[model samples]
Target: MRAIQITEFGGPEVLTLADLPEPVAGPGQVLVDVTRAGVNYADTHQAENTYLAASKLPMVPGGEIAGTAGGRRVVGLTADGGGYAEKALALEGALYDIPDGVDDMTALGLIVQGATAWVMLRKSVHLEPGETVVVHAAAGGVGTLAVQLAKAFGAGRVIATASSPEKREFALSLGADVAVDPATPELRKALIEANGGRRVDVVLEMTGGTVTDQSLAALAPFGRLAFYGMASREQPSPISAPSLLRHSTAVVGMWLPHVLTLPGDIMRRAMTELFDLAAAGTLKVVNGGEYALTDARSAHEALRSRKTIGKLVLDPSR
Candidate 1:
């Protein structure tokens, strides 16, 4: 099997391509012949040694892939970091049957970002109908899905925030009613105006740092903010307990790997709904450029540059 292995923690140049023995499925695991793999920000973080969990050396850095096993075409997550290869191992529970008519690239979208967006709104936050919802980084992978899911789940208003004009427009095309550029200093005022002078009911916050406190200040009464990632790599502003009590607002933290520890029912349901929407052609999975497995370094560079849009995929066969 061929894979991209990071022998040391450093930049994209460290993601070297190499040949390795195919991994066998263990007692509770299944071997998958990978077709398309998804490249994520977490992969860059892991390679740079700044992720929440440090990655082991000489490791493959992908966590999810769309592939086949046992004559069944499936898309799923690997138990360890091995999705960047022609084959990988996944727990049976992690594998999902790909719906009919969904291609590998589209199915790949449902792995990390897709699942996270679905779980956040459909499970964690439980966004209500007729309530205003705000999505941060609304043009990225998770953000694109989050914006669409917010509208599909019946939020009365969806406000999408992005750093640039193009991203904001892309979010609007994804069903966000209002799109705001947060690059300006007056984030609070911009967010408020986007929401028609009303506080937001549900906020999908992925970036960390000062944006955390700003998103909190933009919350409505009895609102909920789900903090999922710190893409900015900066320390998020702490939430004051007194402020929460005074405003009747709540803060929720989400780490996708941690969520995988619980029962799979909710995630299963979310996948079903998301796939159904995609199959119906009602939801479009925003996918970026496709890169060859050997070009993993360039892919990581595009991601860190903050210029790439949607989910970037890697084709090992390419």
Candidate 2:
């Protein structure tokens, strides 16, 4: 089997394609013939040796995949690495069957981002009907899905923040009631005005640093802010617990890996619900682009540059 390996932690140039022996499934694991691999910010973080701890000299970096497991099409997260290869291994519990009519790229796109958004909206914050939400990075992988899920779950208005005009337009097309440039210093004011001079009920914050402070100011009394990803790459600001107490607001952290470890029935039910929404056309996965396995380095560069919108995938068979 051929896989993209990072022999050293550095830039995209360090990712190289290499031939490796095929992997055998352990007692509780399943060997999957990977058709598509999801490219995420976490992959770039691992490439730079900043997020996950450094491994041996060489390591595969992909984390999620959509493929066939024991003749059944499925989507799942991988515990270890090696998803960048044509074949990979996944724990039996991590795999979920893909719904009919969903392609490999779309299914792969949904596994990580869809699950993240679904859990955050339906479980983490427990968003209520007619409540307003502000979603940061609204055109990115998780953001796109978050916007749609917020609307489908009965959020009265969805305010999205993006870095570029194209991204803002994309978010609006994805059902965001208002889309604003995240670069603006007065983003909080813009959000309030967009929501008819009212603060939002919930804020889905993916970018940290200054944006975190701004999100706090944009929340309504008793609103909940769910912090998921820190794509801004800036130092985290000190949070004021007293200020939160004064406004009766809350800050919640979300990580999908922890939620997936719940009882088997819960995990299965959540995944099944997301797939049903997709199959019903109430949810959509925007495929930013697909690249051949050998082009893994280019995919990393695209993600780091923030030039890609929605989810990107690597086709191992290509």
Model 2 poorest ten-residue lDDT run: 48-57
Instruction: Name model 2 segments beyond 4 Å from true.
Output: 52-57
Best by TM-score: 1
Q: Candidate 1: RMSD over Cα atoms?
A: 1.1
lDDT of each: 0.86, 0.86
Model 2: per-residue Cα lDDT over 1-318, one tens digit each: 889988888889999999999889888778999999999988887887766355556798788888998789988888687799998888788898887898877777677888888888887889999999999999999999999999999999999998999899999999999898877888788888989999888998878888888888888989999988787678557778898987899989987778866876556777788888888999999989899999998998998898789889998987
The total number of steric clashes, by the backbone 3 Å criterion, in model 2 comes to: 0
RMSD of each: 1.1, 1.4
Q: How much is the lDDT of residue 164 in candidate 1?
A: 91
* Candidate 2: pairs in clash: none
Model 1: per-residue Cα lDDT over 1-318, one tens digit each: 899998889989899999999998888789999998999988999998998897888799898888889899998888888999999997688789997899988788877888899888877788889989889989888988888888888999999988899998888888999888766687777788888888788889978887877888888889999988888988876667899997899998887877667875666776788899889876678878899998988999998888888889999997
Q: How many residue pairs clash in all the candidates, one count each?
A: 1, 0
